[model samples]
Target: MASDMESDIALHLKADYFDFFDLSIEKIIGSGSTGDVVLAVHNTYPDINRAVKRFSLKEEDLQKRNISLERVKKLFYHEVEMVRDLDHPNIVRRSNGIVCPGYLAIAMDYCPLGTLVDHLKKMTSERIDKFFPGVVAGVEYLHSLRIVHGDIKLQNIFINADNEAVLGDFGVSFKMPENVQGVKSVGSTMGYFAPEVLKKKPSVDPFKCDSYAVGVVLRCLVKRRRPGYTSDYMEEIRSTKMEDKFRYFLERLLCRDPCKRSTMSEVQRSLIEFTPDRYTLELSRKRCLEDISNSSMPQQKKPTHKRSASSSS
Candidate 1:
């Protein structure tokens, strides 16, 4: 009887593979080292769109890769497991997944407006301010769960259909091998990594590292440009005439010592106490646009926010 039950379970798992085939790809959304994300719709719910991430490994690529397939599989499942357990308004939700020979696909909510990176390129400080609280709230929620989002850059932040900033790519830390004894170089982005990570400290605090990245992300949003390295932008920020409190906030985030950095809770408190209002948001946008128009940086012809479907025109 036990043997028969085990066989039944195995068959059920085998049958699950068919679910991935039901997704019809609309277009390629994004691609990275691990796989490609496609805008797709499930056959059962053709009216609604979903983002399907498919992992495919070719023979030549697999043979030339340094990491083993076993390691990659472990990491991928770790991400799925982590995402499956999270329930937050600001975090992107994963719906389902499927696995087959040499391929794996996971479906998640589709963000139609693209990533914060795309918006930041043209958005002014006012527009960035609108999204700032949502970003911090999302990160604060993650830290509350004791899960560190290894990568938290503008590119990983998506704009939902409701015009809210929703954080995605929140589980890249699973890429690390479970048994690694020393500081493993997971190739975190340069400017976003905390100093301890850069030093390859044996036990770098992932939480602190994430907070540091949030600081960089916040700075990039305000500056409306990529903050390449801490050293590269620290001096520039210091020289710029920003509000004292905001400048101090960014400085504390960029603190080299992890212990000196601000906690997400503390950052949230500061935001609530000193949050900029809509008037300030508009004022800042105007000032920033004037500066850009007078400077050498390429200015957008007209950077306008798209009206949300639910909002009055």
Candidate 2:
């Protein structure tokens, strides 16, 4: 599989004396806790555009923040190694890892259509069905490796050029301990956390927490509303009008009890078994293109702004 992927992908960069000067940085698309994500294209492979997350820090600053520079570097390398090797269509592909002087960066394919959140404004009822399977497949891939995505929410799910959902920002993702009972929760955002996680219980099923989050993400996909607190969002979901079967399935996902909550595999199976209208998939693509076209005209260049993140898009 790796060799096959290599055959298809021409540019496979390594962490070495990669010529930093060769990268033509167009703009800084985003800023995260580690560093800035600059949109760039390498001189050799301009066709392969990338979002480069560059990490640069000083020992003095780390001292002030009471953080260990070595620890930070260790985690950065871990993330690079973890993401760079993974091969999944529903997950963002890591194109390169650079370890040049005063630079530690990971480059991924740039998704021009923006995140799933960007399309929520026009997300029709059936479009969520269109995206759900892909999202489930991505999450399933991570869990199959026993990798727990501690943070899975709106901002983390990026949309590719084909208008498909791909999971990114794996800074907090970790391999689940052999003890299937639970794993210590690491990085997270507030609104999507499950009740057990919100309470900070010592032992909790990480996958359930993620499944609950997936439910929240799918709900937000069409609702175009960011959730508040877990309890509040639960109430909102209860009242929100959706298909009876979907609502029932969501009930399984959002169930407070981790034991009773649906696993991602179960959810995937259910989706595959039931199957939504095939036409809805095409309709979703059509609508996405229409939305992009309508917004593309009268191109207005917006100023780049730095925003803190646990990881890059």
Candidate 3:
């Protein structure tokens, strides 16, 4: 019965979509925004393992206007153009994609290691420091392409099996135009947003927003707590208000003025020269590995939230 169901799904999927990575639908590893499914596929006629993303255009209610179908089409085109144009090792490589009836998907390289958010939640500072360079490099590469990731939270960044950081989730990226009006409410986590975003101030810069998010992630590594939100420690950081080193870094990134924040290039330089405190790296690594191993074993599906169309840029 299971085999029959799998075969049915295979029949529905288009050949052009499946041929790029050379795998069937049954090998799906995960799914993302808008039922975007990622499959662990084989290369060279079952020689090697690769990952592919397929976009499904099934409407919840075909009787309705089917706005979801339109969104899927737009997103598919946007992702293909963006990913094809971008050439960064830290960014997931797009092998190919196909737009077929009820099925549209892209092929990408699979990363066995999971999201950085999950990894960071479990690890200490030391382990994070050792692996932080990859993140910096990835961000630098994005900047080189004149793109602002807009969303730089931990969930969008993944760690590979080799512990290298790979940036993903480019659903809200933007290239700066010379005469651009400011973006209002780009999708971003509350605790991770910069002051400019929170205040909804005009003249906000997209690059600075990315910088603020990076600072938030860095603070998570050093403090083991999400900053900007109202926690006891966060309150303490707020009260100190730029006195503490970590808080200072956060403030610098989260500065209301875009011109004040450090650029991705500067961030890369800092990560390379950084010397972490003793024993922090090993402890963080152990904790992260343990947490991920335990959590990934029995994955529970969470309710999906509707993301706002607003650009964090």
Backbone N/Cα/C clashes per model: 0, 0, 10
In terms of lDDT, model 3 sits at: 0.63
**What's the distance in Å from true for residue 282, model 1?**
20
Q: In model 2, which residue pairs have backbone atoms overlapping below 3 Å?
A: none
Error of 3 at 261 (Å): 1.8
Error of 1 at 214 (Å): 0.6
Winner of 1 and 2 under lDDT: 2
lDDT of 3 by residue, 70-151 (tens): 6866776666666666777777765454555566666666677777756766776556755556666777788776677888
Greater lDDT among 1 and 3 belongs to 1
Candidate that scores best on TM-score: 2
TM-score of each: 0.74, 0.77, 0.70
Candidate 2, 223-312: lDDT as tens digits: 677766653355666788877666766788878777888999999888855575645776798889968975885565343312322233
Model 2 residue 74 distance off true place after TM-score fit, in angstroms: 2.4
Q: Rank the candidates by lDDT, best first.
A: 2, 1, 3
The TM-score-based order of candidates, best leading, equals 2, 1, 3
